[model samples]
Target: MKGASSEGRFVIDLPDSDAALALAGVGNQTLHSIEALTGASLVIRGLELVVAGLPTQLEKAVGVLELIRPLWQEGQIISSVDLQAAFKAFDKGYKEDHASLSDHILVRSKRGIHLRPKTIRQKAYIKAMETHDLTFGIGPAGTGKTFLAAVLAVRMLMERKVERLVLTRPAVEAGERLGFLPGDLQQKVDPYLRPLYDSFHTLLGMEKTNALLEKGVIEVAPLAYMRGRTLENSFVILDEAQNTTSAQMKMFLTRLGERSRMVVTGDITQIDLPGGVLSGLVEACDVLEKTDGIAISRLTAEDVVRHSIVQKVVDAYARKDS
Candidate 1:
């Protein structure tokens, strides 16, 4: 089964030279990845491609290629996300599921880049947030937990589904003491909330985001500011919940007023809480998992859409920890 027979050779006629180039990627790296994945040889000449391998390998190679056909067929460069997601789709359902994953666009930036779910669990996570009043997305870094939540929250605000958008995160220091910083309270904590600010800047253009911030349509604050307030008719996102204590998380949850939606996202594995301190996010998952009208999505490394290396890094650390 390892050697190719004459019958094992299958030639595919590409639409044109552009299709061939797009499918093969720059320097044929994508083709090489496909070969590595399916144990088949893909040779593209002009507008023809020769796929040679065992019969089963040929079938698998062809099936895998079909999952990414929609992008290549449109002359779009197949990215690592596309290739990786295609491989995942191949292992799970097939071409139909791949199409569905690519079609669930959350928001398009001013650059025309479609912000969409890059994995099936991401799709489910987005769905959970949309359908539920309170949603929790617990996952590893680079899984788009907070980015996707910001996207939906902004979309809802624009559509008047929510009166305002409030983004808060625990300003807990990972290694350094927050009090040692040389500034007022806001200045000291702004660094901790920069990631949340960047997400909004990318979602809405810089000028609009600043204007909204000035008008209080968008508010970014440290979690400590929400202690005694009721956030009504707002979309509230509590990021970095892993740094919150049980008391802090309880206060934050109770602040969710009527006609509001809340999305809590954090990487429990990356908890920076002091030793002996329990993460509120961890405890809340146990407490509210069975509560009515709440949805919790736990995404693994499989859902990481960052550079493929990030997934490897996550898995490597996980192995060491285990």
Candidate 2:
């Protein structure tokens, strides 16, 4: 391997053209992503990569490349998702071996999508889900709150830990009124529940999801329908709960029965409840913070795993609000 001794810079010579191509990705997108994430200037000349920046950033960039190089060398394809996880882990002061971060697979979807925690908070959230009967995932969007909850719920159902899966969400609109919606009650509320449906579709293919829905093994409905039912032996997830009123939240929580697990996910900052209406999620947390068998996992912009700009957008709005 070629090496450079320039101050605040390092050069790594790839072992072969295939390894270099894998590291660089198609059109050098992978190299560009690393540069953007670590604030390093990565330039490729033949099979050689030159990383130049501040000492710390250069070090981080080189370290990330070194951690991922083995995967590529072993003929494993590294995607942007993998790189993002590495970047987040490094940024969050992860001291463990980086390979461990990439190796911790949470779930493998039917379509072969491997889901894992992209940040430290996410790792803790997954642990909380496993250890607690009720988990409150309070966070900003794109933090994998609902997605991970759905993944766990599907796994539980497949393993027969629960006989069924229940997914619900508040129907409160951000600003629009639902009165103008078309079709019957189910149709009116289906739009609000589409996100949960999308999650299940991702984990279990559309065909199997539809079959389960038909068999009543999977139920996707709005929070209003949960008023008078006792959920037993099921994995239930309440998404977008910030819009629920105090009474609604209490009712939903009370429905949890024996052999059941519930995950409540919401972004409090995006609450759409009417004036003077207290959000059930916020109030429930205040009341249940000390309760046994319940756990809360709070995720922040640092836990966001969407497009990198999403994290910046969350930070920008947070700064404005503060």
Distance (Å) between predicted and true CA of 194, model 1? 1.6
Q: What is the lDDT of candidate 2?
A: 0.84
The runs of at least 3 residues in candidate 1 whose Cα sits more than 4 Å from the true structure, single-residue gaps closed, are 1-32, 39-54, 73-77, 92-96, 174-176
State every prediction's TM-score relative to the real structure.
Answer: 0.85, 0.85
Q: TM-score for model 1?
A: 0.85
Tell me the whole-model lDDT of each prediction, alpha carbons only.
0.87, 0.84
Give one digit per residue, the lDDT tens place, for model 1 in 56-133.
789778877777765666555777877788877876765676678666767776555567787878899999999999
Error of 1 at 229 (Å): 1.7
